[model samples]
Target: MYVAVKGGEKAIDAAHAWLAERRRGAKEVPELSIAQIREQMTLAVNRVMAEGSLFDPDLAALAIKQARGDLIEAVFLIRAYRTTLPRFGYTLLVETAKMDCIRRISATFKDAPGGQVLGPTFDYTHRLLDFKLAAEGSLPDAPKAEPHIGPVPHITEFLNKEDLIQQEPANDKEPRDLTREPLDLPADRALRLQSLTRGDEGFVLGMAYSTQRGYGRNHAFVGELRIGTCAVEMEIPELGFAIEIGEVELTECETVNQFTGSKTEPPQFTRGYGLVFGQTERKAISMALVDRALRWKELGEENVGAPAQDEEFVLYHADNIQATGFLEHIKLPHYVDFQSELELVRKMRAEAMGTMQEAAE
Candidate 1:
């Protein structure tokens, strides 16, 4: 409403220069290369790709470098860049059972097929930080095995054979693609899963934790958690055949939660599902818990008014790019608004003093 700030371009340029210098830290210290980030900081790159919903590790690494190691900012960059890409045909749904699992385990069963391969996990390692790695950023390579080529079986099939778990009827209906359309309320299970797949890892983790803390108790057991590479296929209309185009790393989780019989339904165990873009077991497990909580209505359970139970709340706030943008907007100048508040306070003080003087007289 007021005159535009005159020298903003110059000020912005100067501020940006300062920021660049700060980001680099020191000229003498060697700069971080994209390769170093891609290889050494693999987890960060994976997280960015997971949240960004883009599978290009190289592009993600570049974005991470440009964003100065801010994962949320890197995600934003990747999202913006992704929108410009031309729409292509969709890929086929990945087959988890056929996954060449690098790591697979089942908590509910002791003798799961593939025999609980503890492939590359930090679960058993001590928390102590070895400062020796600071000087020499390398270690003696651990033993590696030729991966099992045959299909590793799922633990759920065993329970399904017994008819102890609730049967999930196959629904071939096309799921709503949230990426192409604006999000709508009363989202379906697929839509909710889409939101969670690209949602903030920490936010999803915290919401899942709330369930364990009695906010919305769903006694969850890790029925199966697997991390592996799976083939990505697309059906070529001209060829009339689905052919493998590439492969992607994925972390898939299935949780068996408690179930109570309703008046109309028989008692059986319920399920929660999670599938993330990479080896992110914690995120995947957490995603399953929150995913189950949001299904209160579908499960015929009463609304406990828990945060995770609110689908609208979870889906809306799950996006990190939106969250960071709106939150960071407050840092912008609010000169006019501040001036109005300052004038009002000054006037109120003056009037108060005048009234007190009159009363004294």
Candidate 2:
């Protein structure tokens, strides 16, 4: 066992005091407000919320500021704060079909039913940094339009009508909440999705990239990717009906994978789905690819022994908070453990040298 040496309660308190002072750098500069972080650093806030499994933008922003712009640390703070919250009734499943989309597109079809609406995106922008922004220069106002009046049906629906893609039968089973219970192996699709949606973006992205590099070989085509705000509804017992409580920005991706057929089944394309918080297209796309790779068994495909295909491996390591905690623990006091190892190594060395001397004699 490792034991603490010189560090004491006073030292810890002093360290924390220094940390708070360092978090707010320089008296001349204006301090970053929670509102500023929420408004300006929206993407970072969204990531923190998504990974933290909490949808409070304000809380995420505060965590970000308190953590001094460390997104993972912000996520950790948010997660810890989330545990203190009282459990309320669960919300109904969000209907993506009725999403008030700001950005929508389909790579597979040129003329998708909803038509491509390129809402605020960095896809077409040049990589060059704008020097004008260094001084916080203002710019012209972007044009706006009236909100669309109808539902934007999924692109997969059109393909499903032609029986070109596999159909997903509706399952109304209540998904298990991983937070409430300890994670068990052989997790269902719902549990897997829950873990993945809150998983580390970099880890998921890398795992997805591996599949593209012939690790799992799931050829994925972005059938549809849409970003918008969807209403969150919860059933009120007093009211006796579900009512919209709030709206949340979401990024949903549906990837059409390679066709699979067998002696017992007809040829049809498979699907991989991703639904994440905020305008995280890259993360959503990566999520879809990895989701497909993990579905090898369900899709009747042979196990490729890829890391992405291993559900246990992916789920276990995907949580950044857990991974970071385990990794960071190594930095803690290991003095006793180290001394024991040192003594053992020295004894072994002395014995080997004594034996060599006797042989020489």
The C-alpha lDDT values of all candidates are 0.88, 0.89
Q: Which 10 consecutive positions of candidate 1 have the poorest summed lDDT?
A: 1-10
Residue range 1-361, candidate 2, lDDT tens digits: 3444766999899999999999999989998899999998989998998899899899999999999999999999998998899998799989989999988989999999868888877899998999877887787677765445458999999998999998886888988998777678898888888888999999999999999999995899999999998999999999999999999999999999986686545788888988889888888999999988998877778887999999999999999999999999999988888888888988999999999999999
TM-scores for all predictions: 0.93, 0.96
Error of 1 at 349 (Å): 4.9
How many clashes (backbone N, Cα, C below 3 Å) per candidate?
A: 0, 0
Query: What is the alpha-carbon lDDT for the whole of candidate 1?
Result: 0.88
Error of 1 at 337 (Å): 2.6
| Deviation from native of the Cα of residue 168 in model 2, angstroms | 1.1
List, residue by residue over 1-361, the lDDT tens digit for candidate 1: 3432435788899999998898788999999888988888878988999999899889889999888898999999998998999888799998888888888889999888778877778898898998879876677887875555557777887889988888887989999887788788888899899899899999999999999998885889999999888899999999999999999989999999888966655788888999998788898999999999998887788889989998988989999888998999888877677778888888999999999999999
Q: Model 2: which ten-residue window has the lowest total lDDT?
A: 141-150
* Residue runs of model 2 more than 4 Å from their true location after superposition: 1-4, 144-149
